[model samples]
Target: MKLYVNNNLLLDNITIAESLKIRLVGLLNKKSLNENEGLLLKNCSLIHCFFMKFTIEAVYLSKDMKVLYKETVKPWRIGKLVKNCTHVLELPEGMTTGIGIGDNIILEGEKNGKGQ
Candidate 1:
């Protein structure tokens, strides 16, 4: 899959199966994450899991790759749909610097008809 932030390509042809094995420390030090220090995206879910903590940031996205809604949730927190979200992207703390509401995130992957 490919990840684009504000139309800027970040990761091209990234296979989540392999990327999933990335540890927290390496993810935190990754530079090309477009302000997002860490990412845990699979299929359509973006989960930023803090192994040392109890918090996770979840952002649901639409089919067109727009952020439908976002939530900073803990383990006990429940998730709800604020919009028609088909995907989700999670980021580490303080990683959403230049991003905001209505921002469009373009994702090209096998699931979205863009085969790798």
Candidate 2:
């Protein structure tokens, strides 16, 4: 799977972390994220960077896929809790320059978050 913006923004391959086990181990076991890779956590609002080896960009999105909040978190840090967010996109650090609040994001090959 992949994450996109404005139909073509970013175009990064992503792993859908919907299950509790996947979400809990998100990015923790990985040493680094490629420039074109990411993680999308379904039904998530907050995140932590404890034991992480690198920084990352976190984008909180609503169920409709609208950007609700964004932040840059470093290793061993806790991200701010965002309200009204149903998904959280994790990307390589500093990769969120083009995204902004209210912007609509899309997941490749999915509609309303249901895998196609």
Candidate 3:
């Protein structure tokens, strides 16, 4: 369940803890998240239900894959911009630090040859 950008490993199957109530309303494999493309959720929202062992670097996105919010969320922290968010991209912890909001993400990498 690792999130990747081309050959670059963004988040390696990081745990999505219960701290966030994330309802996977719509899902696509690697093809869904595009390089330089944005994610837009049409009919669903992601919820964070707080619990234990929740490991994720949450990257909040708008309908056009524009970065709306970001946080290196663990077990107890709250996810920002829960509302009005069209998509949530979870990267590895520290993968998105200092990356300003409203900016587009450029997914870069090659196929690392590692299989889940």
Predicted structure 1: lDDT: 0.51
Candidate with maximal TM-score: 2
lDDT of 2 at 26: 91
For model 2 the TM-score comes to 0.90
Off by over 4 Å in 3: 1-45, 52-54, 106-116
lDDT of 1 by residue, 1-116 (tens): 66676887754643333233342232333433344233434344444433334444556777766766777655434556555666556554444554566778766665322222
Candidate scoring better on TM-score of 1 and 2: 2
CA lDDT, candidate 3, residue 104: 69
Which stretches in model 1 have alpha-carbon errors above 4 Å? Answer: 9-52, 108-116
Candidate 1: C-alpha RMSD to true structure equals 6.8
Candidate 3 per-residue lDDT over residues 1-116, each given as its tens digit: 34434344544433322222223322223322233322222322453425524345667766655666776666545566565677676543456654667776444334222222
The lDDT for every candidate, in the order shown, is: 0.51, 0.85, 0.46
lDDT by residue for model 2 over 1-116, one digit each (tens)?
Answer: 76678777585578888778888889999999999888888988889999999999999999999999999999999988888988899999888998989988987754232232
TM-score of candidate 3 to 2 decimals: 0.48
TM-score of each candidate? 0.51, 0.90, 0.48
